[model samples]
Target: MGEKSEIRMTNDKKRIVIIGGGFAGVQCAGTLSRGLARDQAEVVLFNDENHLVFSPLLAEVVGSSLSPLDVVVPLRQLLPDVLCRTETVRTIDLAASEIEYESDDGEIQRLGYHHLVIACGSVTNLNVVPGMADHAFPLKTVGDAVALRSHIMAQMERAEVCPHPERRRWLLTFIVVGGGFSGAEAAGEINDLVRSSARYFKNFHREDVRVTLIHSREQILPEISPDLRDFAGKKMEKAGVSLVLNARVASATPEGVGLQGGQFIHGGTIVCTVGSAPSPVVGRLAAPTEKGRLLTEPDMRLRDSKNVWAIGDCALIVNAHDGQPSPTTGQFAERQGTQCAQNIIRVLQGQATRPFSFSKLGELCSIGGHSAVADLFGFHLSGFFAWFVWRGVYLFKLPSWAHRFQVGFDWAWLLLFPRDLAHVRARPTDRVSHAHYQPGDFIIRQNDPPLNFYVIEQGEVEVVRSSPRDQNGEVIAVLGPGSFFGEKALLSNEPRVASVRARTPVEVLVMGKNVFTQISSTLTPLRDALAQALNRRRVDVWKDEPQAYELLKRTPLKELMEPVPQPLLKPTAALAEVGHAFVEHGNEFFYVSSDGQTLDGVVTITDLLRARAAGAAAQTPTNQFMTANPVALAADDDCAVASNVIRECRLKALPVVERKDTRKLVGCIRVRRLLAYVFKHAVIGAPDSCQARNQLAGGAGRGMDWNNPAS
Candidate 1:
């Protein structure tokens, strides 16, 4: 309340706060400044950067056709009447009509406002496809453009120095994911730049360079008309850009991108122009959201909030003309900004605010080699004429006369001279990242150099080793969630001994060898956990007990498991009936089923005791006390696998099913029976082993027939 009072003051002036400095925020401030006098309101715009980026022309920056500074206008220069503050906003307190931000002086401050405009745009997120965040380049900001430009040039340099032909081709290849305006333009520009600059490098040839664009739709530029899309696609292909339509990226890695149907496109560089997520500030808002954008009223006001408005990429505003949500584009953002400002002024003057309504002006996309496509009003344009029109339209769209002139000059210079090839040589920093693999995808192959240590986050993977008996390779172990691998080779500084392949779609958090070593050496808890897992998973742990290992490996689970107890209880049976059955059969657990054969659930003695102690009625159904879909073994599984599963799960007994896909109950194997059978059959040379078998066998030695192990 005190903060509100201070912000309002005693004067008649009102304070309007704008949270972004993009096109929407700039347009809103411009409109508000003209509509209201100095005494009526004070307009303040907050942006982390002091400049507004002309995003549509960002591809030109990557192509080296436009100077980086030419596409950006200083906010202070653009909005002379509005107060522009370059500070990071920490949070927006909607209820208090205040915003908390960190000032340039490193102190937290809160400012109250009569009206707040949310224009903070969306951010690039590549996590939709696994390993994309780690391996793909994103083109969203000016910095991203610069970084990508540098990387492109760096790849060219590497390709020149490489002696191997295939390696050189890999270095020269570039893959762009997405078919939207950004993707099309970026791919075009990149192809043009690399092909044109090939002559500058001694060993570089235009034929060796490959630029591929992958899209999940049938055509490129789905926003434009079908004819225009076809024209653009054909024109780009003629200009040497390969189009991969109706293909979706399943995963991305340093090697390349893997498509959904197991096709891998090999390339050294991957540029992702898809996947946008809400900005942190916008995500923290309490308002309703669609997809990731805040849902606003037709007049651009935030739903349920009187003085708060939202526009641009962060907002989902329905258009009055089409009765459809407005597309997230610069033109729509500008229109929303202007309409929102007028509405705010109307609210201040006690007048009715009008709904936002506007028809789209046009769309222009520039492909490489002086070609473009345009959809203006109802007319379609393409080729060199469209390219010229595209340049002319964006030239005047520049906020400042100086920027327009600078960009115009750059375009003219590009037509007469070659594209720039020089780039910064700063080394990229390395960090831990995440990756995804599809079923049968080899995460690591045997004898391959260890580069990354992996921790399974989702799905399962199998440790496989090549054996003389099986040419396809024998599966040693199946690891699920919370299990980790690839550390043994990394820690020992040796090549991998066994290959790991995804048993299902898998996600893993990957750490580089250097990072894994540093953390494993310093973190005590992680070190101890890794050591314990290593001891349990060691491949040759039974080397000393050869005979015992041979017996466990050669025997099948069906031979070692006893028959399932007779008269399985129905799920409708009473808890009292289950207790009585357990006592009568002298079994520790009973299987529950609806039919006579199919297993539904298992009820242990512990479960019965728990249900009784919880004051459950004796008439309570057995299903209520049963553990459904319990861990089970397949009838064809070897005794060794069952032994490992039992030891890992710390279970006294495990149920055997007909197969993994079918739930038909076959039999059960007890730990005591398994250990006793192994000891009695295998010859024990060690004296301690004989004593251990005598203690384990106990009363079983009197009545049990050693010849029938499953009895």
Candidate 2:
């Protein structure tokens, strides 16, 4: 108790870490901050990039309708209170309750957490096709947009200087792969840009620029109905985009793309819109997964680690309504973020958490200016109507009201000015040296002082416990590739409880836990929980297996120790507004208690003001000024129940009481504590606090705000 007291004194506020700065991750951070209104919790957002890109509007950037700045929000500005880190997540060590990633300076870090929100988002899948990496540009990010724009413009310049007609034609050719939204939109917009810009080109005619869209599948816009696909294809054909169906490029080179049907298309520019895979971090967890996405229950929680959560493109969320996984889209991602936030709150409040349901409101695709196709609840529409709807929906969906106005202005001004062509490029970093370790490799010895955690790219390991009871060790569990060990000891300064021996030749990601804490503090909650859980125990043992999970199962939830209890009314109860209570010691205001509980006071900013307005001196009794009833809660409750009490009562804070004595009010548990609970765990449950300290020290908590109550 004394140790915990000292720990609490040093660290008063709860910390929450969000891993991605994308739509889902950002929304989670923002919502937690706003919904909770206290300084007891902090929220942090983490990402590899310092800016938040509206990926859905990447086509606009390529089309010159929006500049990178207009579509991107600097992390520091939007989330001033929330910490932000730009780093690439390499792996998730579920067993040790931490995440490992590389920082901007190339230093590896490990983040410990109590909860985890796997919202790393998706990346363009470029490894599937041979030569794609060397020959094609993917329109998934700002860099891709800039590269395509520069290449297209450069081609135009070269066409004017080239004397040979064939060379100029090849220079003007543009090939797009996948024919999906990204491919189709880029093809259409580039075609429009070239056709519109050709009037100013000295030698190139509009006919010189040829745009071709290649699809391996039979249809385009697979999200839409078959009829709509045909309509979209016809529309593209009319707009001068050559549609190639039922075939894929066998290989791509700087010279051109070779199709499977023995046909080769020569083009100076190739924009590939191949499909995306779940973030590589998802692939690093040894949990049940579908394809590259982490497998989550209907409630968007990991199957084995119930307290851990996976959302957005990184997770395979099973829809309870239909028993199918939700589609990976911006809309669904937004919804999942919101739902996950709510569930996190619910779990903290000791309430029943709900499963995630895919609510299909509508789907829209923009072919070009005022040219679009949309399905709003199965009502298909095309052309201008769809365009308006698309514009309005996206405009409203922008993160902030400021963004909506900016987008509106951009739309209006695009008609007057040509698309900006200033190029923004991200230089590639030096390649990392490949390190190898075979199965049965002794990466590290058990009980050695803290060091780095490893990310497994391949193979497996055995987690063995060698206690004094037996000279020979017993294998506790088998950890396959993607599973991480040795983090707990590094994270909490505790001795390793078990030995990890590679079962097969394996690839491992290694990083210092402190560096991770510094870089990813805000982006991960599981680390926070792990740290908290570790602190709860006096004698800690770091094991290679799922010790954290097992410990969580064993620990009984208890009411937090606090001040004397006083019962008050639930916030939801109807009451008349009254004047403030008399000010007392230390700027405190007194208010009436519920059911004639004299000691129970609802002292707040409002109560103090009412007394001053009435010119009541300090000598006046606080009883008359106090509200007749104030909200109250039981101490022996889960976070979910506490949250519901606040929501139901419609109050800012509630005085908590022991389950045996509801009339007695203990130390107050405000909405902020609940928010902190959510923020720290990234989910809802008890956490290992020691791991969190290492995560924090290691820079794993780069983006978390420990003081932000909303988090």
**Poorly placed runs, candidate 2 (over 4 Å):** 1-14, 37-40, 101-110, 420-711
Q: Please provide, for model 1 over 81-178, each residue's C-alpha lDDT reduced to its tens digit, 9 standing for 90 to 100.
A: 99999986778999988998876666677888889999999999999988799779999999998889999998999899887788699999999999
Q: What is the alpha-carbon lDDT of model 2 when measured against the actual structure?
A: 0.64
Report the number of the highest-lDDT candidate.
1
The lDDT of each candidate is 0.83, 0.64
Indicate the TM-score of model 2: 0.57
Using Cα atoms with residue i matched to residue i, what is each candidate's TM-score against the true structure? 0.69, 0.57
Tell me how far the alpha carbon of residue 329 in candidate 2 is from the true structure, in angstroms, after superposition. 0.6
Cα lDDT tens digits, model 2, 487-584, are 56766676666666655444556666665455336656646544542332222222221333233223222333344332232222222322211222
Question: Model 2: C-alpha RMSD to truth?
Answer: 29.8
